[model samples]
Target: MQLIKIDKTQNYIINTGTIAGDMEGTSGGPTNPGPLSIYLEEGRIAAITGTKDDPYRFKQPNRQTTFLDLGSLTILPPLADCHVHLALDGLDFATARRRWEQPGELHTQISTQLWDTVRHGILAVRDGGDRPGIALRYRELVASGELTGPVIRASGWALRKPRKYGSFLGRGVPAEMLDSALGQLARHGVDQIKVLVSGVVSFKEYSRVGPVQYTYEELSAIVQGARNLGLGVMAHASSDEAVALAVKAGVNTVEHGYFLSRDTLKLMAEKQVAWIPTVVPVAAQLTSLHPAPNQDNYVIAKTVDRQLAMINEARNLGVTLGVGTDSGASGVRHGYSYRQELALYRQAGLTPEEIIRCATINSARVLGLNWGRIAPGNPAAMIAVSGDPLGDINNLRNIEYVFQPV
Candidate 1:
């Protein structure tokens, strides 16, 4: 498996086994019969037309067109990671933070993580905030072609209440200084605003999440402030109380919503706010490569099960659900943990097609990218896998080629 960067704008006609979704990119819909032809012009899909029996029957190629045939591989929209922390390495938090002070070392570390992310067929990612603003710098590096990585939507640094739990994410701001804080972030060129509405989920105590960080009025003011700056807010909310408050306060997306109630999910649906339930970071506690000596696996397992149930319920309530591996957390690794996260989605009873939709289109929507669906006029960001992901989601692991738009 290798990642191929399609940076140059040239005519390309790629023939593959099948397309995973219909022309509109809806999951579980009729897949185009293969061997199908996908025509790309100027980095956008010009057309996709073919027949199974006669692969090249309707083919018309120009002199400058490049032709490639993938006999038994399936073509689908590339994956996207809705939540991640590029500054942390997931192995040793202290060590990663120390390296942040060394610009050369930090650059090397993040560059490797980006390559790993692309190797896993993920072409875009929305980075959670870090106090040092390292991820934001990397976003600009990638955009300028100085670094080859996913298209990044980076929250420069999270905003948390004074003495809250997000010290590592950003500097704390008092309620009275909310507008000034947002102005600072906007001046730093943040793609979105991240707010820590709550602390975190507990591992020792089942269903025990950290306390809510902001009052409803305070959170509402923060959301409005970000909106006024022409930015969306990504709230780091865990407990049901915090989740409810954030949703009502008009936060754009909820991250790490561990113990959300069904009612809150319904409200999120009504409000059209997407949820990125970062279950992998929590579930990874039970299956860490280096398990803690006194860790309580039972409580962690139960917590994961409950989160999965809510995920299923969220899907049922028509709430937009995005696939997010809180990569770079304690037990989650960049690129590798993505498959684990999707597998957990399957445990939540999401069908393979549904899971694919979440990882592709839904996550793409969260990242504000237009490259998830493989339709005419869509940016040609897709991956070719050896087996049909619609039949079995694990087949996505066998990524043979990635079509990334520079």
Candidate 2:
């Protein structure tokens, strides 16, 4: 085992132990003043203890092979983006899918996006949904290390009502065929299931004031079916009723909850449901000029105001917010949008630490991953930035370095 000892006077001591996944957080702070002893035995921490008399007394067999003087690095847990769409940027949907269909083009596209995200300090990502098999393929590439990017967990295609809501971005199976559709996705090894319950207010044709795609029964069926397969479900909801239905159906996380009512937010807190409020898409819609019918000036202005109000309300109600960006959507660029999300979160009243938590641990928890924390034994997935994120959350936008399990 290899051990690295970080003795921060009284704040904390990180002892990298032998066990591959051993991690410990102590409240007593660092060990007595000494040359923070570090030992390595078989690529894992053998033992780390602080004592003025003999810091290396706990050392086992092997000698220290590498040493990096941690005189200036502020170590913290890696970050995760809970909701992202790998294939949807400002680029057209047909073009993105066409790129994916080409041999190696999909890998290239995902690799670029993933690395871009990593450079921005995101180490783990949970893709909400995309066209069939796109996310699955990217997951394999990332897991295999054939691609250098964030650790990825993905849903197959999103489930949308035929010819409505996310139909263009997902598989639109008839209500009666949802069970079979879910089964097919499970067979394809999707990590989770994504369901589109409502339209977005920013998209004029599919505004929140219009009817939702799935009836409560349909939504319930999708949730129950996905649960039966031991898979979690993430719902794309933008209206009050849509959020309520998704929460009642027990979807693990609500994506883009743009129009959640107070009652729905309360239900989420009560049910312990998580939220991935992707404000980037709405923000982009409000600020960009893409010439789409959905981007009508007046409509965008109204949508932005309403969405911001809803977000503020959700935050006030203490929803378990996770960071996410509909990155692949028009005007929502990949790496930059995450920064936008963090800023938006702050604007919604979250402090720097709270926003970081939302981006890292909360997002990881939403995706059911155990690698968000930076302690002994956790996967060595982490990043290093220039300034203190505690003082300025925007420091995350200026990430200087990244370290993954390469």
Candidate 3:
């Protein structure tokens, strides 16, 4: 990896973990005290000390490299998008496959998506799942430096009960055949396991709660199976029972818990399971893609409002929430929906620092990565924004640039 240094004279390094009144302070900004020294070596932070000018003044290990000055730029650890679909944004699986039928076409699409994510300052992404080969192929390309994108940790394909939610892209086999399916996915080198427990309301079919995809027994089996193989499980559950089952089954993350109850939220907090509300898909479906007709918009709007209410309750109860844009649904677009998620989180009553932490440190922890902080030995995945996001959360949408380890 090539070494690069960004120097700023007047910029303040606000610590998000501190309990300061305002985000900015007197060290340089209006609220928080700033760090005095920050050093990077081999893509990891070598040192970070309190306000002491020239903390590394005595150390003279290497002076052969040059430093790149980024005047007046505030640097922070790279952001993480906890929930996203690399293969299925707006367009369906059939369309994506047709567009990438020829060799290198799929590679190009992956490259564009990855670069777009980096441009938006997202350094790590947890791709829920896609068709078998797509995610694995892209992961290989990214690792080989053949692509410019965030560090990807992907589930090869989701596993759902036959004829259930996302069955097309998931391995919807019988319970008797699940072991074989998991074995196949492991051979394909998946980073995690994705299980679909309930149907999404955004999809026209089964929108109004009817049949859940997996039983508690089935979920437990799959969870145990994945754990035995040393893989984590991410579940797509929207209803109360489904979320409960997923939690009971020992799933690590729950996606789109729209109808989660207060008890369920408490259980999640107790179990330390991370939640990704994915409010964008539900909101976009009602407003942009499938708008309500006639005078019934009010009723439909209330349903969306109810989902947000559940999220708010979860937050108040101390559930670990992460950033997720259920991108690639019929109407949602990838790379842009994340901003909507941030806005929704704020609307659900989270402070600016809380919201940023959800997208950065919290999301990274959910994905089991050690690269979210700017401390020593972490990956040099960092983003620089024009304004302090602690004061205004919307500044996240206006990311200036992103740098990922080469």
Q: In candidate 1, what are the lDDT values of residues 1-406, reduced to their tens digit?
A: 7766664446788988888845244545647657788877777787787763433322334436778888979998999999999999998888999998888898888999999999999999899999989899999999999988999889988999889898999998888888898999999999999999999877778878878887999999988888888899999999899999999999999998988899999999999999999998988888787776666899889989999999999989999989889898998889999999999999999999889889988889888887768887788899999877888999999999998877
- The TM-scores, one per candidate, come to 0.95, 0.84, 0.86
Top candidate by lDDT:
1
As a whole number from 0 to 100, the lDDT of residue 55 in candidate 2 is 47
Models sorted by TM-score, best on top: 1, 3, 2
lDDT of each: 0.87, 0.68, 0.70
Among all windows of 10 consecutive residues in model 3, the one with the lowest summed lDDT is 14-23
Q: After TM-score superposition, what is the CA distance of residue 191 in candidate 3 from its true location, in Å? A: 1.0
Task: Quote model 3's TM-score.
Answer: 0.86
Model 3 spans with C-alpha error above 4 angstroms: 1-32, 35-37, 49-51, 57-60, 91-94, 100-104, 202-207, 287-300
Clashing pairs in 1: none
User: What is candidate 2's CA lDDT for residue 252?
Assistant: 88
Per-residue lDDT of candidate 3, residues 320-342 (tens digit): 88888876665567677778888
Clashing residue pairs in candidate 3 are 24-30, 24-31, 24-32, 25-31, 25-32, 45-376, 88-328, 89-328, 90-328
